[model samples]
Target: MPRLARPVPAVAAALSALALLVAGCGSNALAKQPPFPRSTIQANAADPSEKPITGSPTTGDPVDPAFAVDKLRLLDPCKLLDDDALKELGKPDDAVPGGFSRCSNFMKDKDGKDLSITVEVGQTVTSEIKKADKKIAGYRSYEQVLEGSACFVSVITQDEPGLAFTVQIGYKDGDGCVPGRKVAESVVALAKGKNASRTAAKGSVITVDPCALPSDAAVLEATDKSPRVYPYGLHNCSWVGDDAEMTLDFRGGFVPKDDKFDSKQTEIDLGGVKAYQVQTTTSFPSCTIKWVQLRGEDNDGEVVEVKSAGPKKAEFDRCAKAQSFAKALLPKLPRA
Candidate 1:
């Protein structure tokens, strides 16, 4: 028999190393292959015709249900608290829907002090909870003080870390966070699926587009030049000119509860409508005025604000100028 050829140890070691290198290269090459584009998959998933009959398809690893706030679209914050809950919490007698994902419930004490609950629905809560000041009910928690009266308790959903909501509760004489947490708990307990239906009545301020409030002539009269309109959101607009600036905002929800301007505000009558005019001397000379299209309700009306650098190159009063624009714009506003 041919002498058994003892393989060279060095050569054998080299071969083994080479095989390992080849295996690693194969894995890297597989990794470099492009993954299926998520956008394409999402598009297909979105179309009703593409759903598989037997199993649900997903884009990636399933999200934790605790962090999911999408169901908020189906909920109305105003409906979360029953009469018993409301009474137990001092009976917030009014509910104001701020938007699709927010609401405020409030009542006033004998002293004209407000007791209120405000709720906001949010997603991406997991990250927020990671930095929470406390933990409650197996959820990340935090608190905030609003205007020195209200306490807000924010809780991250345990099933879905990225989903969360806040309950803002306050009584002028009581600890805000304590009530806030209780309300938050109740809200969570009541967070079952319920259809949310909302509508803005015709000829209402809620239906008006703030950017379209000013006419060309009104813009010229107020700014002394052509107006450049910038819409900040569904209910806010701004106009800019050479030396003038004006903003139209929706302040219905906040104006009713705020007393900050009660001492300085003066009324400006526009036809049958009443508006509050306030002059500010801080920062720059400016005037702000609010008019009611809908009163006694939250998020109810339009606020027109005008600002200038100072009294210069002017033949008119700053507040008067603001008032003039508001008056001119009022008739054009939607009528209820």
Candidate 2:
């Protein structure tokens, strides 16, 4: 049996809005910004003859995620499951290319409602098994039904210490976990290692773990109090001080935009990285800092914020507080 570790934190307010929107559970009107657009990038190179095939050619056969999770960096989810594999799931449609982290498809039931399947590659840890309900394919697995809305089956793969690739299914009726497990199993079977000979070394800015981004001392120096950690969400963790709250968000899907803010935007520097500062004074006093974490190929963004209100209003400049936290946290981000 594999060991179980702690679960990766849930999506913060920002990502929770995304999840809800994607799940068809709510309207996105109140979301901070529009969801990141789906990626249309395909994997094929024009001339197969020009480039040499590296690694064993993908057999599309099941390999244990414990051994192949790192290879997900290269696996295109749309191509991962072939047509025949989709057929087994009841007339599977074409896979919908999602954001960098997800792929999806759907089939209709007798009544014509859609039953959807989605695969996501994201931050996960082996210890998540501690919170799982059962074992599937030698890994700890979780089965959940969102009542009438959807069902989910998640497996903690042995990729990195805290990362897992997941398969989720949603339907209007019956046990959604039934199909969720089926899709989860197929995803496991599809997991394969890339050829070392042909695969080039690549790095990802999205892989940064939020929980590891700030030290206790840094949190203290920035907020002047002890911090609390909220592991599950868009922000890696939330630090709560006696008078202020801070959130560190690693935006894997959407970059920050100036148009999203009704307030003035200020540009600043954090550990040599260019960042923008926004102050929100309407609802309450708060500050938000957004910076580019990975540019060019990935075009990803990162954000940190500090907000104080109520009794502490007279003590600090919220924007300055946010900047101080951003400064303290910037040195900790990956520069390369």
Candidate 3:
């Protein structure tokens, strides 16, 4: 008993070193996991569904929240925001959403900036009711005053393959803020027709009144009587310009089914505008899932498809939006 095992100093030193190495790795293991199948906190926890019932600091905490925008996603979520990243700073509006609770999935540029800044404009003639998911559609924007400057950071969702904001990010000159959105709006206002920087969003599926026309159509109604422009999003549905009737796919994008699906456009003249209506049904089902069906009639799988006019078009993106909108619309439509 008096010996006290002092005979193995070398062994004791080796054991201590091994323990420190293990501890170091254990600390970072949570943050070091890959982002694909999506990392879950329950990986190490014994119970996957054992959610905390009360508000406690012991809730689902991430080893690392800023999981490099390239990896962490709200279409997926990373672990958690670091202690320093949470230091609330900037303007009153900068702290607008507080933690940007409505936002998920932080997507930034190469230099690390949030991009979810697209907002809806004008009043809707119809209710802002969701045609698809009942929840309001949008994301979060982060605003903060950094170094005496007003700055906003938003997390844009990857609704499609690329960025989701109608407004792009602007460069920082050590003063002022982003400029893409401003530039885009200006372009939209200046647009004669196809030249406008007017971008549209794909939203929940909603039925259109057979007697209704697009908002843009109302504008052209004062001018040409050939091609008509179909405005989308309630405010605008159809417009007549030269001798053509334009179908605004603004409410929906071109969703293709297969290569064999028709790639033609429906030409109509409203107020002589010379507009082309690219039907979603005319376009091939871009995705095997979310296939669009006839709005009312039991046309079965005989859904139509449509695509844009020119060569440079977003066929796939348009189809995706159509599919999503159709899926949302089917459940809400008056139903045949």
CA lDDT of each prediction against the hidden true structure: 0.49, 0.49, 0.23
Please, what are the lDDT tens digits per residue for candidate 2 over residues 1-336?
A: 111111112343433423533353122222212223211111111132332211111222223533343355445555544556657656665455443445666555445556666666543333344457687766677765556656656776542233455665566666777867766766666654332112211333344545567667766765676654433221345566667666665544333344232246777776676677776665456777776555333323333333333233536676766677677766665564
Candidate 3 lDDT by residue in tens digits, 1-336: 000000101122322322222222122432111111001121111132432122111122322232111222111011122112222211111111101011111223333443222122211111111111211123322222233222223222221111211221222333323433342333223221233122211322222331132232332332234443332222123333332232222122222334122246444432322223344343232222222332221211212222222122323353333333233323433322
Quote each prediction's TM-score.
0.42, 0.61, 0.19
Better of 1 and 3 by TM-score: 1
lDDT assessment of candidate 3: 0.23
Question: Distance (Å) between predicted and true CA of 230, model 2?
Answer: 3.3
Off by over 4 Å in 3: 1-181, 189-194, 197-210, 213-251, 254-336
Which candidate do you rate higher for TM-score, 2 or 3?
2
Cα distance off (Å), candidate 3, residue 209: 8.2
What would the per-residue lDDT of candidate 1 be over residues 237-307, giving only the tens digit for each residue?
A: 56666667666664333334453334688876766766677776654567777654553344233233433
Candidate 2: residue 151 lDDT (0-100): 62
Task: List, in order, the clash count of every candidate structure.
Answer: 12, 19, 82
Q: Quote the lDDT for 131 in model 1.
A: 61
Ranking by lDDT: 1, 2, 3
